[model samples]
Target: MSPNVKSNLRVASASGSVTDRRHAFADLAKNEDVHFIVGDWMSEYNMTTRGGGKVDSNGGSEEFETSFTEAFLPALPYLESKNIKVAVNAGASDTKKLYDLVVREIRARELNLNVAWVGGDEIFDVVKKAAADGSDFRSLTTGKLLSEWECDPIYAQCYLGGFGIAEAFKRGANIVLCGRVADASPTIGCAAYYFGWKREEFDKLAHAFVAGHFIECSTYVTGGNFSGFKSLPSPALSLGFPIVEMEASGEFEVTMQQDRDGIVTVETCKAQLLYEIQGPYYYNSDVVAILDKIKIKQVGTNRVRVTNVGSIKPPPTTKVGLTAKGGFQAEAHYFVCGLDIEEKAAMLESQVRVALDETKYHCLKFRVNGRCPEDPYTQDAATVDVRIFAQSRDESALSINNFFRPVTDTIMQSYPGATFAVDARQAIAKPYYEYWVTLLPQSSVKHVCYIPSKGLEISIPPPTDTQDFLYEQETYETNAPIDLTALNPTTRAPLGNVVHARSGDKGSDCNVGFFVRNADEWDWLRSLLTVEKVRTLLGGDDTGKPIFRFELPNIWAVHFLLKDHLDRGVASSSTYDVLGKNLAEYLRSKWVDIPNKFLDRGRI
Candidate 1:
């Protein structure tokens, strides 16, 4: 009845504050079929008040409770009167409070309403209990103890699956609030419960997952960042949250509320859908849905029919990203001018160092940018901006700021043609954060799986051992075992260019690599990365000698580990063109038939 009540459903996401709720409520009131009013009230910054800290790897804190109390207080009357349900994850840092508030709010009003509260991975108590029960909190990626990282943890929550909310819906909760659930859960829950989709029916879940991805960031999908977005019918009033019309047969159309100010055009929504998604492997706890096969059909100005969604078995583990305490860092900026010129600027900077040597700093570093003698002669003469950085533990890092005042005066008086190109200022340097990649052993985390309306809760079996999971992958029907021998490496004469590939700072724990390609031959390049090449690239030999290769999805990638090949320098820098000249020369000599176009298109 719910899925069929209308061909499409539109949910509205707006501020939980009373003032903002009025704007959304007014829009919802006009649309009789708009099924849900959604709110996002829990972000990391807001959760600290409710005894939740920035460390909650799940998005935001249980601060959803505060948002709930504020928005529901004003919108309840309008929501109930309009027969529209509300779904939100405003329970920021506190799940228990969030659960209690919604339960009590509905019951206090004497309404037997379906208000569901989804719990998250905020398991401080669970971890304590497990520890008391002699359990270990070892890092999955590194076999290190949790205590070794010195993380200032305020919260630790597991990312919840969408199936849990469907269970809550079965219990008749009209509204749903989740803790750190994936942004797509609401869409998945609505589709599975409303349409009665099953486990074997993965296509429907994939459809719902993608629909959620399109609208998860709210207005972004509605025309916010659309490259070709034209004038909206009503820019001020038309933008709203999204909805999916999923059916038993696994077909769905994404649309928003009608009769609003503006339009929800196909081009706009498609742009948002594709924005920020890294590639074909769309991941979640229980499903790894591929986005390549999905088709978007523009039926009208504001609607797109989504079809041909393909689904695959999810990875056994989910990656958790926690921002932890990693000491303090600070930076100071100063502008050194060259009047009689570049040589003068360098001398002035050297004089300031003599002044700094008198002071005690735990650690210090200096970098000179803009108008140095070694710099290219693009500028008329030479003027340089020198930035000095100092870092230490919390207390010591504060000392570096003191140097700013004295250094400013010394440069103006002592150095020739020395004027402050930019005034010297001091600022706090945030910590160099690190990420540790660890698998949540299936034994530790549980997956409670279910189908629509079945009331049967089936726990997905744990994956076989890690080695088995890695080695036993059966190639999907759409993909075949690629024949590597038929493929020929494109060789070219060395173009005398060098490219340097290095790991992103955060990639200290994870393996970050890159490959080369010629700019024009980017299309159809990914097909060249066969299973054999992937295995070879990702594989390790007994000697611990690193072997590297790349698969071309769209770009002809010559992937290799940064540590292995980049001890001296990477083939390229993050800014691809920096080494273009060097790379052209290198590829010409060592490579053959290399897809020139594939390698060229990945220039960032």
Candidate 2:
């Protein structure tokens, strides 16, 4: 390990979607100087869905792994020529399988790439034994025990850190495949291995950790899913993925391919920094990243430097995402247009209820989307989608054709201009599952790195200390209220006009973080957006739900976590905004008073 020479580790995110993004892989592979290329292809929902079939039987499926291999095969020659190392957690439930496939492909092509697989993230047997031994496996969202779970889990896997990936790289493995390491583990692992960052180098590790967090979702920090996407100079469709250039001092600059579309500015970086994080302290298996004191600056045309990252102690336990076959769900959508949209939806609901047996389903919901225009100027303006969703434990009762037949049958006699959104036959019942997110003792997980070429296996241990590093909530004094009457003139505009926000979901809960561009606007933002004010912004959505507000004075940001906001998370949620990606935009659309002085500064 060379500590004297500062390493400029350039890592790029190749894939970010749950499914295959072969184009992204091809795009990142074009950069010959990239040392590490990472891809994130797993999510809790997809894990359960992909693992539903029999393991070793005729019905067994490895479609997820197969899709990745097919998409990634195109970049093999380029990667080998450039000697670029690849790290990805595309192996949702089967890392070994993916490793074998890659090795086979390399041998078939006569390539010299060394492949490795990191496992031990899967803890199904451990969890099963614990359950039999009367372990509660309490729910993180609701404090209820796992004993109350309606069905047995499909599988249980813990979130491992970057050490295992680092070990693989240390063992001379050029391409490392992982099962369920933290999303940023590949980037962190590569950086750690290249710079020889020890466990004790918490500050340096924390900076890499934050950098990993920023680019884990690929183009998210590059204006792909940004709230101010409309104002961005580049078109969102062809946006470039993020690349991080890490310095030994722990500071890093986030940039993207020059030929690709997208801009990396302070606003975009700050927006992604606040994405999905709970509070000032962000926890991972490797270290607790204290992000309250971080700073962002646009140093170049498309480069933003993130510095001053601090760290606290690591956690004693790692989080385990448990998925169980909850039940079967079937849904159908009917488009309603013209006058009395609400009346048309209610009438359709009444007719469907009389036709279908309600007792056969365990859960049922009817949701109406969009609104009828007072004076229609376009066909879309007068249209609203009415969806009927039904879930049941008995598969036969929730059969697609049988469950949705009632809705389809009524189309002939329903309200005027009523029709199905798509082919009604496409409404098929499929298995939906509940995601139980809980923590497991770090010592229980055995992380191993295996290099197939040398047949070498290395064991990665957890932190020596077992003390919990759970962050103690800090008490923040609220800023004094601003005298709105003192301002000369105020314009009633959307909060998003001056305030930029980023929001995402954490299982059943969701967090939305708001930040300002200027320091003077920070005071007004802080004073204007109190807990009460935020609750008002949520409108009826906050009914009976708990909302906690946090302030990060150093970064001039205020974050709020809405509990149980997402019905049952992404997979099973009946809500249209499954991942809560639109929650910030929804809040931003709400009108609020903005000071004329702040607006005059060209912050529109």
Candidate 3:
């Protein structure tokens, strides 16, 4: 995709309130030029709930769609008036219900409406059908249904892709609804149909994919939860919706609601572009897109247009998103200070362990961190906290209350500084469980077809080699090696760069990391920074375990078990998580335009 494409058409971008998302449709209906309606809905967790827990269904429940429905339902009348096509992935968990509701609305209005529902990505149906077919579920990954990882037979469904909607469009569905389709697919399907783009034109498809990444999260492009968010003209009302005007050549101009609140500055767009998304190669489904060297044109107020986008061959397969159970554990922490810290801490821990004996829980665990008086980080800190966190499904609460409750008693009867902290009256208990699952790429699974649009006979070439794929531009350098000296020896960490970026709450914990292009690049970087070099330089026993891991081929880089690394854990615990989080911010700040500066900088 290139930034030079010209799109003179006037598109309607609407915003009102959640209750009037449908009424907002009046803007579309009133505008004769409006051809399509796109809705944004989803969150970082992809789950609707504000907090975490075992939910009723795989993708939370349909009830979670309440906000979306309140906003989307009223749009039905306007959609009928314009004969415009509507596409949204708001189906979420009970997508079928949403789909049925929309279809019913269209029909009851005597509207000539076509609706298609996209589901099956939830994996619930796939697991069930496999069971009915007596096929192993793992075969989805191995191309043979080998059931290596057992799934809740009732919960798994085949991962669905966007191509199915092309088929829906072909079948005369003006409205498309889906569950768990790749985010980029929605934008790609619209562009592919509008421009008569073929699949072999992987470059344009990839460019559209990047465009989707920018605008898919709705308010994200308009400064919602953005880094360094500033005073907005009207955050309390008139929230914006993103708009992408694409030309036949696959280039697009990204903008937000015209005449809406807030300034659509390049900085706002760039900040959104740089949010959690690591760069050079932006990715989704199996497609890896190169965004470096792509041009951004500020052609109009509130319009930061894009063009000259590039694409690469899709991976040989798709990654499945499945959730499964791991195990269970619990943790509780307390603050303590006073003299003979280590000794008092030991006594406190012993007392807690004895409490566990009084209350039988499946498994109990404990740890104590002692503070020295001379430690610079802690002034006059001659203290020891006997933190007791226990793990077990049954009777775990009994152990925590029994063990840590006596700390107050100790302050009055035996320990010093015990009175310094807040009341130890309440014992905080956090329940835990393991969530582990892997994805199987769509290429590995068998599917019936890739549907085309109505009145459009689209021909997608069979999978081909690199030389045959069509891309708008090429700018990626071959993967480079990582420098080892940049990391700390004892901690095996790279000294993070100083950054001026901040997102979310000041103290809120975040999971942030940069994503490279592919597994090949990751492996190359790992080999370049050999364990011997890292261990020798950092002085830490290099088990060579990467604190960071990449979900390969999909090209997502991950830093797991990071809560503690960012200083959200026990005090005096090196505060590495804090450093790691800062390191992520530093990388983002330093490399906004220079694609691989981190690789070139030799050290952190």
What lDDT would each prediction earn against the true structure? 0.48, 0.81, 0.47
Which of the two candidates, 1 or 3, achieves a greater lDDT against the reference?
1
**Which has the greatest lDDT?**
2
Using TM-score as the measure, name the better of candidate 2 and candidate 3: 2
Cα lDDT, model 3, residue 482: 52
Q: Pairing residues by index, what is the TM-score of model 3?
A: 0.60
Tens digits of per-residue lDDT for model 1, 1-604: 3543434455455532212333554455445466665555543223323333434335454344553565465556566667766666566555546666766776777765555555534545555556578765555334466567555444444555566666666566566666656556666766666666654566667777777666665665565533323455545555665555555555667676665444566545544444433245556654656655556667876777877767776566554333343444455555555444445555756776777643355446555654545554645345565556554445443453455554565755665555553533345444433333233444455544332233444454443422212211222211343443344443332221212122221112112223222333322233443334334433431123332233323222323222222211111112222212222123223322343433343322
Rank order by TM-score, top first? 2, 1, 3
In model 3, where do residues sit more than 4 Å from their true spots? Answer: 1-34, 43-64, 107-112, 124-154, 157-159, 231-238, 276-279, 326-437, 441-604
Q: Give candidate 1 regions above 4 Å deviation.
A: 1-26, 29-32, 39-73, 100-114, 124-154, 226-240, 259-267, 329-391, 400-437, 442-604
- lDDT-based ranking: 2, 1, 3
lDDT, model 2, position 577: 91
Winning candidate number (TM-score): 2
Better of 1 and 2 by TM-score: 2
User: TM-score for each prediction?
Assistant: 0.60, 0.94, 0.60
